[model samples]
Target: MKVVIVGNGPAAVSAIKAFRKVDKDSDIVVLSAEEYPAYAPNCMENVIRGDIGDDALFYAGGFSFYEKYKVDLRLGKEVVSIDNKKKIIYVKGGEEVSYDKCLLAAGASAFIPPIPGVELGGVTTAKSLDDAKRIRKWILEGRVRRVVIVGAGPIGIEDAETLRYMGLEVSVVEVFDRVLPRMLDKHMADLYMKPLEEEGIRFYLNSQVVAFHGEDGWVEAVEIKKLGSDRSIYLPADMVILSTGVRPRTYLVEGTDIRLHVDEIKGRVVGGVLVDEYQRTSDPDVYAAGDICSGIDVFGRHRWIALFPTAQQAGAIAGYNMAGLKVKNPGLVDYNAVKTRMVTAGSGGLFEEADESHTFELDNQIIKIFLRDGVLIGYQFVGLPKVLSVNKNNPFLKDSITFKFTGQGLEASGVLMHHFMRYRDRKVTQKVLSVIKNGALRSLANPSHDIPLFSL
Candidate 1:
């Protein structure tokens, strides 16, 4: 068998290894548009700030790992189109690669909203290593003084922190009422915002960028309108970074037999490849993973969530199934942990995503666990226990006084909650809380288990 993978990120890398594990003799080829080898895009911040060098950005030894795995890795090559019927992939240089199985882990591109003057020279997106390199160069040369970020999501907040660390005046504008609206609840988001404000990073909530003002083809100021009012304001900026999330690179499927999933409630076609539990798309010979594919949301509906770990797991499953292992993806769980201004905040599963919920707050720490019929479904946390003062009346505070959950806390919560979903017992919430209090949360580090958290 010959396998052609359309990306070289974590997904493609894992897929290659998985395929080799099941079918060692099969030929594997990876096509990457990027000149550099696979590196964690999430770690690009440290790379930009010089905390870590470019060499440290790679994972599992980068491209050399693929070479050692006996996979043909093609760098700086773009897969333009796929002829499913012909079982061939066309590359940028008019080269065609024949494959028995194709994996479209093409990933996503930074979404640049159609705001006016957005094409100006001073604007850029933080989607790749090359982008980080360019931004770092622009900063080290003292070309940027005042920076404006157009979104308040994780990427936007990260960029704000990094630029501020570089001594640039940073401000973030978000159309939502609060920052991290998708990740944290309003109250939790406000808790996370306090420290960011203290760090001198300005946030303009409920604001939408209408246009970018440019001087000599370079962005000079951003024109934004308050969501509910006719009032407009211009923020003078020497550089503009668009951290406005991303959409899957679905354009690669254009004219292929691939089918994009449609959002049932929104009545719009989802922006990713639709695949079954086995990660097989409409074309039997083609599979998709990573940001390019849609997976089960916390609500049990297909949703496009582009997170790194999910992409890796999905790719592994896709590769396994492609190798005829018949493994099934357990679906995706929403989880994210972001550190801004040296403070960490995390969320897992649902937040205001369900009907019933409970909230507990103490000092800088806040925990809001979502539940359905007495079973825990999700939770969110803002600070560490050492930073949080114990509240005597709060039952959840007893064991949490010195509790130190690892970074895996957020991702583990989804697993525990989902497992509890099977039992209809009323003690579901109490059982999960006990598990956390007994320090069993640490056991979630085991690779096999799905992993939760608080006092009842």
Candidate 2:
């Protein structure tokens, strides 16, 4: 059996290992456009912050691991086209390879807006290892004295915090009203923003960068338009870092027989090549994972849940089925854990500002939850440690459950009973009740199973 996996990120790496586990003698080939070995995309910001050195950013098991597993690894080679009918992939350097099965784990690219002067020097996005090295070099050389970041998402905010720590004058400009609009609600975002502001990071909310001004082929200032107002303002800066969101890298699949979902308003391919329960694409031979594919979420909606853990799950399932194994890949639920000065974790759904069906309370250190249907969909916690388990549950749920922080007087047994009863009644369905009950029984019997319910 011959298998070729594209993209060489987390999803591609996991697929190779999974194939080897099932059929050790299967021929495996990994293709990556990046010149270096595979590394975690999430660690790019940390590398800039100096939390991890350049060499430490690579995966723990590097090229030697692929050699030990007898997998062929190809770096700095781009897979340009996939011919599903012929089962062949065309490369950039006039090379072609045929595969018995292929996994398309090609990830996303950083989205740069169509603003004038965006091509000027000192403008970059943190998408790959090379991007990080360039940004780090600019910072260490003191070439970036005043930095302007163009997005307020998690990556942007983390970059801002790290840059401030490095003694650079940093500012963040976002078109959204609040930071992390996707991950957090206004109340939760306020909690994070207050601390970051105190750390000397300036934020310009509801603003868009219209153009960049440069001198001697380098950025000098940015012209921005405030939301709901036609007036514009100019801000001086030495460098501009685009921390805007990413779009799926689906261009290679275009013009092929593969069908893609296109959004008329956005004017780009919105979702991945559609797939069914078994991770089979429109073309049976081609399978996709990670940001390149869209799947059904726990809420029964088709969404692109692009996270590292979700990508890994999708890749593993695709690899198992591609190897001719009979396995059903359970779809993913929306879950994220982020830690700054405090820790916040949530799953399933977020209470957006437009969501009238949800009611929430935010006080000094407590978060109260309620659902429009009188069930609990979500909750947020700050400065409170005891209520951590109250928020954790199985990923799937039919109805919501309310959560209230009882004082420290609450007994541990009582808390466990509350969780178990909720899990038995509201969270788990009758079909999966036996599995949940048996797992709970095993967990209670073993002391080693008593792991912390949450971690940073």
Candidate 3:
């Protein structure tokens, strides 16, 4: 079998590993638009902050990784289009190849909003190593002193912390009422306010950048408008960073015979490539995974969640199924964690979708768990660690805790998924029921051991 996988991110790497495990002799080829090897996108900030060398960014180091695995790699090659009828992929400069199976893990691109002045030189994005290099160049050349980040998501928050650590005055503007609105519940999000405030990062919640102003073709300031008010403010900025999330790079399938999942109401294929439990696309010979494809959500619905861990897991599953192993993704839940000099917070699942919620608060610590029908569904941990005995001096230095409810690794939102996959029709004994009722989430960590799974 000839397997061709596009993309060089976590998904593509994972697919290569899976395919090799099952069929080592298959003619496997991988294509990447980036010249560099696969590196952790989350660690790019460390590269910008000078905490690590550029070589550290590569996950497995240079082209030798592909060569070792006996997989043909087309680095610095852009896949222009695909001919589904002929089973051929066309690359830039008229390069073409035929494949029995193709995996579209093209991933996503940083979203650039329709705001004016974004074309200015000083504005950058937190997407690729190239963007990080540009930002580093600007900083090293002493071109930027004040940094304004537009968005308070994980990427925005991380960038703000890194810039502040570099001695640049950092300010964040978030459209939502709180930071990490998609990651944590409202109650849990409040714990992050004071720590970030103490870190000298200015925040403008419920506000958005309306436009950017530049002098001599470089960003100078940003014009922001507060929601529900006519008030507008201009913040001086030598550099502007757009952390406005990302959208699936589904352009490859456009104008092609490959099928896409179109929203019936919106009349658009805006979501992503639709894949079944096995990550097989509408084109039986083709498959997709990671950020580029929309898969099953925790609640058994179709949703697009482009997260790093999710991408790796989905890509591995897609590779296994593509290798004819017939594996499924189980389900995916949103898991996110962020930390700065002052605070650390992690959350999983859709707490707002829960029917009931509970909170446990102490000085500089908070834990909120959401439940539906007496079953644990979601949770958020904020403030200092649950216990500071591990590191007394630094309350912020705590191990990130992940509860394992399923056979999979530590999950942020696996309660519902565990029940759905393993305990859907099982009965809960009184002992197991009592343990769950008493917040026995820690007991579920040992998936290999006997901890009765709870049912809803």
Q: What TM-score against the true fold does each predicted structure earn?
A: 0.87, 0.80, 0.86
lDDT by residue (1-456, candidate 2, tens digit) is 888888888777676666667777888888888887778777877777667764567673777768877878898889888888889888899999899888888887889999998999999997778888899898777789899999987678767766765667889999998887776667667765765676568899999999999989999998999988888888888888898988877776766888676566888766876666666678877788787777665444566767776777778778887877756666564444343322232223435422233222323232323233433343333322222232244221112322223232122222222333233224323322232233342332234533332111
After TM-score superposition, what is the CA distance of residue 387 in candidate 3 from its true location, in Å? 14
RMSD of 2: 9.8
Name the candidate that leads on lDDT: 1
lDDT tens per residue, model 1, 248-329 = 9888888987889887799888759998888889998999998998866545567677888878988999899888899878
lDDT of each: 0.77, 0.67, 0.76
Compared with the true structure, the alpha-carbon lDDT of candidate 3 equals 0.76
Ranking, TM-score, top scorer first: 1, 3, 2
In terms of TM-score, which candidate is strongest? 1
Least well predicted 10-residue stretch by lDDT in candidate 1 = 396-405
Better of 1 and 2 by TM-score: 1
lDDT of 3 by residue, 306-425 (tens): 888888888899888888898878887776666444466777666767787766554444656666775556667665523222333432222332111111112322443443334433
